[model samples]
Target: MASLAAGGVVIIGSKLIGGSWAMLFASGGFKVKHYDIEQEQIMNALENIRKELKRLEQADSLKGSLSAEQQPSLISGCSNITEAVEGAMHIQTLLPHQ
Candidate 1:
């Protein structure tokens, strides 16, 4: 099984994007750090993610190999961009092309 030791950074302008990325990475056993400019956006994004996840759970399409606890533990929110990127094996930016 893949381990969560593979750390990742997700820089997003919106919480919706950040949480989606975080959930997928967490399901795949990667530790994820999500960052945005505003904490309120982060909160909103996380809420959206949870709603989607509940739907996924009902449909059984989510990364189902992980336990409930494992999923939440794999993802974290970061206010510091530099700290979020530190020691990350990969970084993905979900921002406007401009």
Candidate 2:
């Protein structure tokens, strides 16, 4: 099992569930790695995360002490699974139902 760096969370997937999980962790002040095989999906996920964070901030419901900008700043997108999981303390993988 891989371990995250202090306050690190690795999200394996860039779909709705994975992205949401990443945002949740980031909002809670965790360093998040948003990973996806498709770069486009990763980009989309990041954009959506930014929007959601802003919404939370505007609603005064954002988690943790970090601002929306700061929270999103803690998340990084990666295509490589190994790199994404490198220093994460927790890993969340979202898989589509077959």
Which candidate ranks first by TM-score, i.e. highest? 2
What are the candidates' C-alpha RMSDs? 2.1, 3.5
Candidate 1 residue spans exceeding 4 A from truth = none
Q: Model 2: what TM-score?
A: 0.88
lDDT, candidate 1, residue 68? 51
lDDT (0-100) at residue 19 of candidate 2? 83
Error at 10, model 2, angstroms:
0.7
| Per-residue C-alpha lDDT of model 1 across residues 1-98, encoded as one tens digit per residue | 34546556465565556577778877777777777888777777666766676677777787758765567666677878888788988788787568
Model 2 Cα lDDT, one tens digit per residue, 1-98: 11234757888888899988987787667788888889999999999999998998999888877898898898989988888888667888897777
Best model number under lDDT:
2
